[model samples]
Target chain A: MNIRELILNPDNFFKDLSSKESSLTTPFLIVLALSVLNSIYTYYETSIIFNLFPPDMQSKMSIIMIFSIVSSFIGGFISWLLIAGVMHLISMAFKGEGPFKRTLGFIGYGFLPNLIGSLITILVGYYFLSNAQVPTLTMEQLQNPTVAEEVISSIIPKTMVYTNLLINIAVILWNLGLWTYGIKYARDLELKKAFIVALIPVVLFLIYQIYGVIKML
Target chain B: MKKLLIFILFLFFLLLINPINAVEFTGIDYKNEYLEPGKTYDLWVIITPEKEINNTVIGVSPYGVGSEYIQIIKGRDYEGNLLQSEKGVGHFIIHIKEDAPSKDYNILAYCNYTKDGKKYSDNRIFEIPIRGKPTLTVENPSVINEGINRIYIKIKNKGTGIAQNIKIKFEEGNNIYALSEGYIKYLKPGKTGTVEIKVYGENSGIAKLPYTLTYSNPYNDLQLVDKRETESRKSKTITYNYKNQKTVEESGNLIFKIIPNDAIDLNVKDCSFPVGKVNNFTLSIKNNYKDSKFTVIIGKYYIGNNQKTLSINYGEIKNITFNIKVEEMGVKEIPVRIIFGGNEIERNISVNIIGKVDLVLTGVNVEGITEKTITGDLSNIGTDKAKSVLISVKKTERVIPLRPYENYFIGTLNPDDYGSFELHAKVINETDSIPIVIQYRDENNNLIKIEKNISIKNLINPNQSQENNDYIPLIIGILFIVGVLFLLYWNFFKKNKKIIIKNNKNNREV
Candidate 1:
């Protein structure tokens, strides 16, 4: 389904998608595109954090950034599968019937909003990081908790974090709505059960995100 | 037998007549036994009268042996009344001619009187000796200008007698002075005797020294002759030439040319000093006369051998140096006195004292949270103005200089004046102070640098624990995030829930 149909008419889009046989091509392509964007965002953020490290340590950060970008790229697809698998398991408890492949495909389509969100977040983050006043730190200074905390806060300001948070919440809510309809149609479950199934993981992820934001303060 | 009787009776009558004479010659006395030419003497004749006589006369006259040289001016004859047994005295004035012969002479004393209308006469003779006159002349008189000069004055006896105990008294002039009088023991006829005189002169020009020459005359007594006299024995003038001895002339009174003690011109060639510090002062002097010794005095108080001795020759220039310390600033005039050739010359040397510049930091203010900017006022507390003032932050292990304001230029600061400066630096952790360098030029264009430590204790870092209390931005960010979350849930979740209910109702109605 097109991005407009997926966003504006998620119920009809998911209903029409469940009628076709499950294919991994379109869903994998969407997930791969989102993973690439996520990897790019991750590379940008990792580079900023690595800049605070000492010169000798910064050389090693390049390798760590490569691994982190790879993990982020792989984690995007894994997260889509994990969300689908978890939702399918929860739907089964509600006496739902659905194949795992269809659930996975529908969950991957739900990540379109995340793809757009990552692009917007990268743009916003690029603006902030480009103009940010970053403090140079030695290994010894970086070890100091107060200096590290201040450095982190300076690099990622409260406004940028909050803005990113609002954007993430909006994207997550849209994904949740799409995922609820996708789960209901793909697993042949009732709307309430599908909504409950999708809301559980999303609510847990939201709580985790809120806890990180609070910890940053 | 009659002729013998008559001679006897005549002798008896002569004795009787001598006893009855009006006046009888007794003796002749002269005041000066030795007569000199061109001089006068006094002579007296005495007579005794046995009876009173009227119109009795007494007289004295030169008779034999060089008598032509002496002339009796008065008492040639005397007419007066004489009493019995009274001594009649006759006074005579005699003058010896300038060309008189030096020999013995005799004079006659006679008395004539009338007794009982008849005339009778009595006479006596005395011898007198004449002495030669003395004439003096000065010769070979000379003087010099350096120090105490010994003037050799040759006194010649031009007369035919001996000049004894000759004394030459020197009179001081405007530029010449006599240290001692000149003296000669004896000078015979046609003989010359030298007298030494000590004198000094103050200037290099013609000078006259008037003197009086005193010597014993032909009678072995003192006689004085000054420059005013026209005789050959009068004191002569000795003219001396300081630069050229050939110019000396023996004319008029005692005249001499002298080289001035102040003939040397003193000039301050170069004077350099700093206030409150010892420095060398130099004086250049040019001597215009003969070689002479000089005592040079620079200032009132001696710093380092202010009094110096120099021996300079004619047409020579010499430099003298003195170490002096001046405590006050600006131009100062020092008096210099040169003592030479028994004279002193005073001069003034102008010395300009350059003041020292003392630039100090008055107040400092450290600004900015992370990147510190130091702003402070610099004051010139010394006696001079400081120019091209610059303030810079010194980089250390913990202090790093920042751009744009790492160094500040303050232009100029006068004495007792101040200027402001600003410098930027980054002080690392636990560094409570940073070093700053202040540099400027004095009035003499000497570059001076001063290093001072500025305390950075007041510099607050944003990462500090105290600054962590400022959580307003974090709180605002959290509140905004929460509001956005609420709005997202209300718009998306509630709308989705209503749509789901509507769909479920549609399914139930179908």
Candidate 2:
């Protein structure tokens, strides 16, 4: 039930969850608290991103960023429910045994390592934010593809972006590893079947993220 | 069969009744087949007798309608006799009315002659095609370059027929003179023939050269006969302005005024010199034309030679170097005159002469030793003024330059003006000469510096005085170092002892 046990001892942490009955509301609140912290970091980073725009556009982007933050918060809770429900259903198909509520609670606890990673990312992002030279970007420059490339290249250092990407990948990999054990303990399935069930949600989430990135480009 | 025999008997009776004539008109020849309206033309008709018949007369009628579009001019020889030759030919001058229609007309040629005591008259009629007139246009007016002009004339036959034998005669005027005539042989319908005429303009103004263009369309295609009509147009006016025309064409007989490649070249061998110094400049005058004499007059100035006039021959170059004295500083331009043949060009020679500055150090007074203040008077002994004068003693290997003895600032000093300065230096070895540097500006406001060495006149042993003054800052610096170390110990170590004692009390209470 404790967040410290979930982080330091994740294997025994999931084993304990398999033996006892837990309430989904408490685990859901814990995940929500971590999501709020991540959203606050997102707000600050988005504000720093808006600073690169011209004065006229920065005012307009402030309104858009507020809308985006509200949508992301709602979207995050829906995604957690969706992934938990999907994992419960997959476990049932594999002839495993577990309550739906327990699977959902274990899925929430599985997000602990990812929350720690998000906290570290916010700290590292602050270091980059202080050293970054905000480019003078205008609405006209953003509309032009060539000028947008120049503005982005000037503001974001390539090495820092690639390093941040690698860190995020490592953090996701760590979260996926924890979720595999969480699924195995909750579903009472083989390790291989638990990994396949865990991998399905993460891979689908990665595909959705890649699709969003391609749409932006 | 009986009807066929009757038809043959009738053809035989008609052939038997037909009589053979002694004289016959075999061929008919006309001067021109195509005629133009409103013009006179000549038509020669050839008449042939059976055996050299006498008293032969030839007549020609070129008309189809009731209108008189054609008329005969001459049908007899110079002796007032009919045309009597092997093939008796008649020369007739025909004129087409101005309002004649453009269509085909019939030309009737009749010949009456006496051949071997029998009179015979023969007549022949042929179709003569009447066409519209030829149009003459001046393609390009006379373009005068240098002194020659080329006039272009074009003739186009806009009529239904062709135009033959085009002759153009260009008339000359006051400013224009014709060099050659323009002529074109033939120009078909919707076709043009271009010709160029060479003309000469004697003066620089508008030249009006009237030209007469004469071309005749053939009334008859065969034979050498033509309409021989003359059509004259108005004169073409061409302006010959030399100032506006700077580009000279390469082709044609162009007479251009020859000058130097560089009109008036003024070269200063040495452009930089001292003020009030005499400098020499090379003035080169070249005449590119032959049989021309040049007279050049120079302006008044301070020169080595009083002769201001110089004469140069044609195609010859004259380089004159005159020494001139510039009285003031800064950049200056000298006026020069270049007159060659009938052409004159005014030019200027630029020179930069700088002013010279001289600073003299006099009346050195040395008062003290160890902390020595050397005083002297600096006077502007040159011909120019000095500004922002400052004096300082440079540091050397043995002697050290000291502070609290600042550089003296003397503002602007005119010619023969003087300013005094006081300097301080610590002399480790009295044998060394103190370098006194004085920085100032010349008449041109340029920053310059002058250095002078003044020998130490009065020397004294001050080793004990330097040793006594050195202990003051050394003792103060050591006392300041001891106070900073005590503050660091009280801030860090004293605060740590209080925290350790508080933690021990808390552990005992637990």
Candidate 2: residue pairs that collide: B32-B219, B32-B220, B33-B219, B33-B220, B34-B219, B41-B94
In terms of docking quality, how is candidate 2 classified?
Answer: incorrect
Residue-level lDDT for B271 in candidate 1 = 64
> Any runs in candidate 1 off by more than 4 Å, and if so which?
B1-510
TM-score of each prediction: 0.40, 0.30
Residue B53, candidate 2: C-alpha displacement in angstroms: 99
True contacts kept of 2: 0.00
lDDT of 2 by residue, B394-452 (tens): 88876677776646777777778888878877777654367878898766577898888
**Per-residue lDDT of B285-384 in model 1, one digit per residue for the tens?**
8987567898998764348577999898888999988888888877888988777766565566778888768888887776443467678799988878
A43-87 per-residue lDDT for model 2 (tens digits) = 877786676577777778988889777765666577677888998
**Residue-level lDDT tens digits of model 1 in A1-217:** 5776776667778878888888878879888999999999999888877866767787788999999999999999889888988998999898888789898988888888788778877876775666444445655566678767766875676666776776677677777887888899889988788889999989988888788888887
Q: In terms of DockQ, which candidate is strongest?
A: 1
Kindly report which residue stretches of model 2 are placed more than 4 angstroms away from their true locations once superposed: A2-4, A207-217, B1-510
Per-chain TM-score, chain A, candidate 2: 0.85
